[model samples]
Target: MLTPLFERRIDRMNRGIAEGSLTARLPSGETRVLGGRAAGPAAVIELRSWRAMLRLALDGSSGWYAAWLAGEWASPDPVQLFALFTGNRAALAVEARAMGPSLLAKRVWHWLRRNHRSGSRRNIRFHYDLGNDFYEAWLDSRMNYSSAIFRGAESLEDAQAAKLRAMLERTATAPGDKILEIGCGWGPFVELAAREGRSVHGITLSTEQKAYAETRLSGHAGARFSLTDYRDVTGTYDAVASIEMAEAVGRRYWPDYLAAIARALKPGGHAALQFITYDDAMFEAYAANVDFIQRHVFPGGLLISESAFRALAAENGLLWQDQVNFGASYAETLRQWRERFDAAADADRLPAQFDAKFVDLWRYYLMYCEGGFRGGSIDVVQITLVKD
Candidate 1:
């Protein structure tokens, strides 16, 4: 009952395919030719197996293809499956190279200003901002919306709760303290903090999320949501925190993002930001994974090198207080999300394509990220900072 909107959108996406710029790998480990219809909008590409097509459609790789095929996975987009098989991975690679660290930072900054506004942010809203009801089916009750922490939990709900509690504890916040949550998702932190008698102010880019948070916090006088970019926030707070939203801020804006937080915090105020980052020194092993995320998942996102973070923090007058690594926790969290998504799909609350695509993408995303962490290719770092 989704009407023709999803189908129409799929059609439009296929039309972009007809323009013949798209390319994807086949199960045979070779790229295939996609033929446009002589008179229609759809293009056809043949694969040897439905499993192959599904992998191409879902995971784009055969390694974990069966995981999604057996009805065991989920993610935000189904088209990523199509993207893997029929979209242009080579082009994505080229673009990823264009964003390499060796490239001048100023040049990267200029490119970000030009392309940052409409890339991943639009894609995120197109897929994620549909409604909280859609996400509620799969996510934990807290609706944290960022990656869950999977430490010492036997179940998904328990793990996500741990993640939330960890956030609250790490900040070491007190009741009635003023806190700023950058890129607040659904206001879980605001709700949690407010419940603890803290005055919480949250800023986010998603209007749908802001609206949902407002409703979620309707009775909490200590919590407030604002539809403002981080750069525009001007005030003093006891603490500052951001969860998983720094990727979209882009490396070009990292300094600015840190600067804004530093400015917004009172002198000696503590800040904690948790994010997924690539170990650029290990580029060969993990760079491809990062490229995939940029192309199909978070288009304009950037993963900062730890050294880059240190230098940026120092430059912005932020004293590095402490840093914690939670990569294994994130991997466990993704696994839980995939399971929940599959369950939701089985119950018929989630669309088939959505479930399949997410499973495939998430398997790759999670495993790759997990491998990065284990192999030191990437890290999920919670860096505590203080204004000097």
Candidate 2:
């Protein structure tokens, strides 16, 4: 039965939908249409139980995810719903954010998972150590886990190669220049550098990544992989390339991350970095509460604030340059990945260790991120920071 309090809560959420429309079917066979003020993506949600709304009201995205896990709600196309919420996030404000004890508890738990030296390794392992074979089942041939830059109708593999080339070009390394790749996954960038006759060294906190990278480049005399923390790196390189790794560094360690880059680069050397960023306007609120990604997908992860990150780089004697935003490409990349993942899952190619629930969670994670990029609130960027 639908209670008056739950109905009122649903009404409040509807009022905040400044853009897009949602048609929600309640358990009592009632349908409510919300937010037709403007033309936008329309999504339909079926509420199996009113507790789903209550969960969303109290726990925000994380709670809503829990409700989904419990079969309290269903959506024909969740991507539309996610995009709608993210696109109208500013107008929705606190309506979709955690509150009360849930907020406080999640914040404390997130603090505990901060990316300190040891915690960094643990956190990396939590996501990346799912085994190389597991990722290989779904990822591209190059095993590029980050966003790929698509040009026209090229394949995902070609797009990923283009992204790698783009990042390397930003570094402008000569044939003999030594290149350091921070958070190198599966040796794609390092192998490319080594093939170009550059002395390439790749570092990662994930044991699985380091092992896979080293094995992948075993025949290349100029390529090496190390399990090392960025803060502890102890050498100057002609160029540095860190692809989509900065998000793993928590907000408290932004300075440390920039300082490490500054210390590792030779004078006038360039550091090409690919990082995810939150819209400047929404960063504070996003940081204040634990979102679905932070709570379940990537522990200790926080998206960058471009202004603050650039300021930190400047403070560390690194001049920011050639910033490129390719968030739409990321959305497409994620969509492709999800398609591949679903194919692999249907074929039973995924590892036996990851059960059905884990698979569903992974699917949701990819969808959530894809929608985030599509909505324009979150973005992925490639930028060069030159050492002064």
Candidate 3:
């Protein structure tokens, strides 16, 4: 059903794949192979209709997702397909990115949801307020929502505990030290710190998170949870820990985020941050258009540019140090989460309000993130920034 113009477009996209192999079954009952020039992950995609190609040509990742939802395409292993596209993003040019009206519309929508103070609360609630029960259905015990460090860990719970301990170690806080946790999701780290007799204050915008954290740590007098913004934080702390939270702070607020960290820390205090970042080469294109994650999963979210972030930290009197990259571990974590989610759905453990479409969307989201991490274009890292 593809016209000559669409056929040429597909050929152009296939030619750009310099590193991997993609076996595409076109809607016209023809098969085409692209990108066998070098060794990489092999992915196969079956186009059920020409509309799939139209969607890709028009809307990029978001459009491709819509095509899948509408049954225009199918892939046995979508993770590899996503990995292929993400890995060769540079070579693929604009083939996998939003363009024209779709690009402009998505960009405008994302800008409206930008991480301004008011919009931050709305954005945070949009994702995290899906209810604690929904998360508890799939998330490991202790409810850590970020990446888990997998070194020497046997299970997802253990890996999450290891990640928490590692981040706590980076804070370098002794007993009785005052610790501030920005964007404390479900109070895992705060409870850990409080159990060690450190005074811990956790701030978040999600009402569910605050309620859950407060009830979870009710017995710990040293642990506190509040609905607070990072920009409005008061008092200096001995150390700070913010895990996977800075991504919510858009590029426009990077300086403000760093400044808040700098101002909240006492002299010589360390602030541990675990954040996701786009490779320097990919940041320009990524920032130029709204991505699937930004458009659907986490509105107002923008991955950091490590170089730019580090420079901003330095400018704000925070010396970045002891960086660790664990993107592969994150990819593994997402795989596990997806499995758990599927199991929960099969067992009817997910909330009733979340229908089949919602479940499918979340599954796709998990795979998309995992593939991005595996593709090496995106990465998750833990770093300690010391206030000088």
TM-scores for every predicted model: 0.68, 0.97, 0.98
lDDT to native, each model: 0.62, 0.91, 0.92
Task: State the TM-score for model 2.
Answer: 0.97
As a TM-score, model 3 comes out at 0.98
Worst 10-residue lDDT window for candidate 3 reads: 87-96
lDDT per residue, candidate 2, 102-121, as tens digits?
A: 99999999999999998898
Clashes of each: 6, 0, 0
Runs in model 3 lying further than 4 Å from the true structure? none
> Number of the top candidate by TM-score?
3
Better of 2 and 3 by lDDT: 3
Per-residue lDDT over 234-340 for candidate 1, one digit per residue giving the tens place of the 0 to 100 score: 88999998988777777667888888988998988888788877655543433333344554455566677777778898998889866788776775676566667
lDDT of 3 at 354: 96
**Candidate 2, lDDT over the whole model:** 0.91
